[model samples]
Target: MESAARNISFKEKANKALGIVPEDAIISKSYLFVSFIALLVGGVLGLLQGLNRAGLLELPLWFNYYQVLTAHGILLILVFTAFFTIGYFYAVLSHTLDGLLPKVRKMAWIGFGLKIFGFVLAVIPIIMNEASVMFTFYPPLAAHPVFYIGLVFIVVGVWMCAFGSFIQVANWRKRNKGEHVPILSYFATGVFVLLFFGSVPVAIEVFMIIPWALGWVETINVMLSRTLFWAFGHTLVNIWYLTAISAWYVVVPKVIGGRRFSDTLTRLVIIMLVVLNIPGGFHHQIVDPGITESVKFLHVFMSLAIGFPSLMTAYAMFSVFEKTAKKKGGKGVFAWFKKLPWGDVRFLAPMIAMIAFIPGGAGGIAQSTNQLNQVAHNTMWVVGHFHLTLGTTAVLTFFGISYWLVPFISKRVLTPAINKLGVIQTIFWTVGMIFMAGAMHWVGLLGSPRRTSYTTYSDHATALGWDPYLFFLAIGGTLLMIGIIIQVYAVIHLMFFAPKGETEFPIAEVEENATKTPYWTERWGVIIVIMLLVIAMGYVIPLVEMIVNAPPGSPPYSPW
Candidate 1:
């Protein structure tokens, strides 16, 4: 078997292999640049937020703790992750759609403009402490009207990006009759569809809240607000998870020298995710008043349904991994793991992230289980667990994608040193998260609350005991900052200094292409209809009761 890589420069391989042209690369680079900037800012806020919780780093008179917390959550989870997903998937779908139409490209740019403008509008108020409602915006504690309006623009931006893909896919399907959607595009379409579905409730919430924040409405229903927020919130995280799943099916296999696990099964899981994703948000409000136990139980059951798709993918990942290793001349069951491409940042980042999900999934189970939610509610345990899922699983996978993605977009090559830097960054990140997650989980069991400065209670004996764990948190947080800073430097280096060159994308080998793919795979209209029907069955009864027999809205609470 002669090497396919032989006699091929990276530039030649990329040019020959990828469907992208210079224009496509340029558009993606714009999104990547802003995403990195947001990550750097959010990364700093995260470090400070952690240290503040540990009773270190007193803020300047200009800054308030709650505002920083709000900014941290909003920027990283919403801006950074969302923009990256939009950008990454655009690139993925563009190839399959035979290059995005010029109008679609224009719409995406317009969307990006709104996102940046919206971020500017919102973040200024946050910096000045005028909008410190926290990311959940649990109302009665209202933000400046600008905050809601800014967020609305962000949502609109997301919609524009999403619909752009929809138009491209619909157009492609129209021109090429009876064609099976390519595998990556299939998953990307699923992400966009669910995102559109998730945004509706959020849009309505923002509409109601903005007027309330401006004093048009005398009161805001805190419970109702929280309920609506989570409706789309869980789906947002699921969208992030689905984007990673796309990598798992397509990119991961290629980077690790394996073919995709199973095309039909992968398509089925993507469909299952879309149909089952929404409506589980009710479980987040298990302890809130007015929602009945029966309804909560129903939500818990539906929330648990999400695990089915995840478990199915888990089976496929393990199978593909083991089979790939066996083909590489490895023997025995566990021994096959050694054949994976550990040194490649593309593989390492997501691998660590997937490993982190095991613990994150456990945390989710703890938080979602109606009974277990009591033990872990509002504790650092939940906070620690949430970090594992998004911070590690999603963010780390994004990091892996960034390694090659930025260079490919910028027409630059990653030097050997930068590649080595990514590996080291992953190590620092994994170790640091272990320390933080371990400390938080331990202290949470001791009844330490999340989102508080425990230093304020240092005079008490129980509070004094938290110092060691707090110390661990500070150490872990500092290391995490180092990891983020290294990546920030890596991104900047590639953007500005790395030598000009083209880079190749790792498009995974397909296992087999049966002459005919399942036609149901392309029947997205039917699937979405079924999803709406299932979701209505779960939500209508609970939500109708809350609206029809409404509680008096809660009076506003302004702490500052």
Candidate 2:
């Protein structure tokens, strides 16, 4: 089979007509523009929340924090992450599949238009202080009908992109029959499956519940809606993180200059993510009064089962890094770590991603245990754990991948000085998050709660213990904001002021003897994902039933 990377050279006649701009570069730049706008909106909301938490600003008495939180969560997690991932995948697939994007130019514009319209509709009620429900869509706390409708529109736009990518892959497969999909594309498709299946329940829940909440419907079952919403929400984060893992698989090896130590292990990790990721949402409800013990335990076990894939990924990637470093003349068990390019943005991105995963993984395990969850549920500990995983690791790595891929995708030359600045900003982000999240864990474990704007200690002794941690968190927040600003500036410079120059398209050289799977096996991967989703949701239904049928005074649904 002809490698896509090996076949990307343009004919001289086409080059003469089109100049240096590749079709993929055009698509990537358009998406980057959209992502930056979303980030700006999300950042403003995040800054406001941080200020409110620190007592630096007083909101109107009638203005609740829930709407702002919802906007921030959706803008950052859904809009920004989805746009970036779409762009990145498009860029990679165009290269790996060795095909020109026939319709991505039109698709990008369409996606941007739908997204902008949806975002505006969603934010209007939020800014007007009319809808204060948080992003979780938890039952009994609803927002304006437009908010749900707008969100559905935004998701629909994303689904279009997913469908477009699938078309691209399918077309590529048709043109190049008998060829195996690249590992990265295979994993990227797995992410798309996760997103597509997960979005189904979310769409159903929002369309059903939003109208009822707004009195457009006479009656609706809030409990049933909550069950469905989480069916989507829990898997949503997994979809985001799986992309991060895919990026890691592509990136870590390149930075270290070696192949993934175990291709089978990598495939298994992707399989496990598809299998174990969705059913584990029940662990989120361990403390809820309505859920049954058996159901919660089942979730706990499934959550723990996800660890196998995580461990496999860590082992395979780290082994490749070690081997690469050793080949570069490093010695000893840990001495090769020092040979790593700590200051390079490309290297530091994956390295810090792995570092953040360590704490995130540990915290996830601790939280999944029934006994341990009793102490940490609804506390800042949960906040800290996710910030490390999603905020620092996933977001930072996405930024890093953009920095590395954007120049190639744009077919332009970015200032090396700006690239260096971007790396510094990434470091600041990693360090600041470490400090902030560590402090949050400490304070939360010491009994400080989450989701409140103010904390009033029960006694002087408790206040004394908590105050310093809060202070450190404030400082860390400042650092993180500054780092974010630096990144934003760097991106702006790259997009507008970067010099245009002729450059070689990045060509990935594969070993001639590289192990390859059959085409049929790759197509069967989709069937496997369908099976996993069925099993995961099937397991959750029994839990949902128990919660719905619980007695009024039972501990499962008690308000206390």
Best candidate (score: TM-score): 1
Candidate 2 steric clashes: 4
Residue 184, candidate 1: C-alpha displacement in angstroms: 1.7
- The candidate scoring highest on lDDT is 1
Q: For candidate 2, write residues 1-560 as lDDT tens digits.
A: 25554443443335434534466677777787678777877877776665565556655565545556777887887778878887777776766665445685466557667877887888887777655666775556666678778888777877777766677777777876777666777777777777776777778878876667667666555555666676677787787688887767766566556555555556667767876766666667777755667767767777787777888878766876787788888799899988777766766776788878988898888998888898998887887888788887788877777665676666555577876897888878878887788878888898777766654555568756776777667667777888878877877766666787543332223434656543444664566666566555555565457456744321111111
**lDDT tens readout by residue for model 1, 72-125:** 989988888888888888887665567788888988899999988898988988
Query: How many backbone clashes are present in model 1?
Result: 0
Q: Which residue segments of model 2 deviate by more than 4 Å?
A: 1-23, 60-64, 100-108, 457-464, 502-514, 518-520, 524-537, 543-560
Give the Å error, residue 338, model 2: 2.0
